[model samples]
Target chain A: QQPVQSPQAVILREGEDAVINCSSSKALYSVHWYRQKHGEAPVFLMILLKGGEQKGHEKISASFNEKKQQSSLYLTASQLSYSGTYFCGTVTTSGTYKYIFGTGTRLKVLA
Target chain B: NAGVTQTPKFRILKIGQSMTLQCTQDMNHNYMYWYRQDPGMGLKLIYYSVGAGITDKGEVPNGYNVSRSTTEDFPLRLELAAPSQTSVYFCASSYRIMPFINSGGGSDIQYFGAGTRLSVL
Candidate 1:
């Protein structure tokens, strides 16, 4: 099953902070995050394993909650470059070879 | 070092027509996946393969078929195309490195193609 992401859309001013959440009904083995700009393929951000480790890339960080089967991406000091659609892909405990992406969250960072 | 390459960046197909979206990866990754993204929506998996000669269906696999004849190529075929199938298609591959870490093959970081935009009239 596909993961569910919160905040369908959000607008932020420069330097503002925002959080996007992704929750799955199945047991999550790992969570992957990516950002997609207009007319561009999705770019990898970071991956968090089920060990509850928080992974970070630049000002963007993500936390995985194994118990809750959820993950959250945190963006601090947002930049115009951060404006794009954020997606969370989940690898379930079922050992599926494919990563199921979430519903997606559109984030726009204005200058 | 081209990560992933997709041919026919943009295409328009008439109803009931068929076409194949070609995807090739030079990274020689063992895993490949096909997904479709509608405007303002998240990606939906169409099919995936673990390696050559292995394929499986994903969340939304209807109206689509795939074959992984070689490790470098995984093509998605759309038959009897409909307007609902018109969307941006992406092909991705992952190495699935560090198997000893997370029991489930650790982490998989997927490298994506530029994507093909298809419109069915």
Candidate 2:
């Protein structure tokens, strides 16, 4: 099933902060994050596996919670280059070789 | 590596028109997927294949068809186009696990194509 993300849209300024959250009803084994620019394909940012692990890219970090079936992305001191749509994908291990992505969070960073 | 490549980067179709979006991956991945992204709606999986002769439906597979006759290619066919189907299409591939830490031929990190932007008028 597709995961759910909070605060569908967010606007930030340079040196500000923002957070995007993703939660799923089904148990997820892993969570993946990707960013898409205006007219480009979605680019992989980071992945967090179960076991309460965390991964960081530049100043951005994501945390995966096994018990809660949720993941949160942290954008600390945002930059202008951070403008884009963010998607969170969840994967399970029930022999179902498929991954479901969230609706997406649109973020606009203003200078 | 070219990773995943999609043909016909942009196309416009009238009502009832038919077309096929071709997706190919250079890496020999067993898993391939097709997704459509509408403005502000994120990405929805339309179809996916686990292997050469296997295919499955996703959330938004009603207005589309797909086939996986070969491991190197997965093509999505629109028998009749509609305005609702006008969206950016993306093709991706990956393994089930472990692309974050270890480098492997097949990892969970899905590589996406440049995408095919389709518009139905």
Candidate 3:
């Protein structure tokens, strides 16, 4: 089953912030985030494990809510380089070793 | 080492044609998967193999077939192409456990290739 993502698209100016959310009906052992620019493969970002913790690098941070079976990605002080479609891959708790992807959130950063 | 390699970065075909998308991995991972991305839908799994000689169907397996002859190769076959099968295809490989590769918490991350863009007329 695929996870559901909200705010199909978002646009922001430089230095602005944005959020992309992903929710799944099944509990997840981990949540992985990837970003895809036009005509390119998705690049890995970070993964949040089941501890309901947060992991980040620079201006990007993500939270995994074990109880709610949801994850939220926060992009702070957005930059032009942040323009791309973000996708979330969820590893279910069933131990299937399979990943279910969200529809994706297209983020466009303007000057 | 090259993590994963997919051939034919771009291709076009007429309806009823048949073709195969080739994928090979150097990491010696035990799992390989093929997925397709349509316009507004999330990536759909076409097929997956855990190890050599074992294949399984995924969410969307219609018009497609997969074979894992050896640990290094996993190929997806499209029989009688249709416009509906025209989309971007990606090949990925991962270990059963993250950090499953060699790094931290077993984050077993998946390395993707520059996807193949297929258009069927």
Q: For model 3, what is the C-alpha lDDT against the true structure?
A: 0.87
lDDT of 1 by residue, B1-121 (tens): 9899999899999999999999999987888999898987788888999889999988899999999989999999999999999899999998765452444433477899999999999
Give the DockQ ranking, best first.
Answer: 1, 3, 2
Ranking by lDDT: 1, 3, 2
**Candidate 1 Cα outliers beyond 4 Å, as residue runs:** A95-98, B97-106
- Candidate 2 global TM-score: 0.92
Q: Global lDDT of each model? A: 0.90, 0.87, 0.87
Candidate 3 per-residue lDDT, tens place, B1-121, comes to 7889999899999999999999999988888899998765567889989889999999999999999999999989999999999999999987774443223444456778788999999
Which 10-residue window of candidate 3 chain B scores lowest in summed lDDT?
A: B97-106
Give the higher-DockQ candidate: 1 or 3.
Answer: 1
What is the per-residue lDDT of model 1 for residues A4-111, given as tens digits with 9 covering 90 to 100?
899889999999999999999988788989999999999998888755889889999999999999999999999999999999988777654446788899999999
What CAPRI class is candidate 3? medium
TM-scores, chain A, per candidate: 0.95, 0.95, 0.96
| Model 3 residue pairs with clashes | B98-B106, B98-B107, B98-B108, B99-B106, B99-B107, B99-B108
User: Taking candidate 1, what TM-score does its chain B reach relative to the real chain B?
Assistant: 0.92
Q: In model 2, state the lDDT of residue B55.
A: 93
Instruction: Give the per-residue lDDT of model 2 (tens digit) for A1-111.
Output: 678898799998899999999999887778889998999988989988655898899999999988888999999999999999999987765564457888789999999
CAPRI-wise, candidate 1 is medium
Per-residue lDDT of candidate 2, residues B13-112 (tens digit): 9999999999999888888999998866688889998889999998889989999999999999998899999999999988643343343322577889
Query: Which is the better candidate, 2 or 3, if ranked by TM-score?
Result: 3
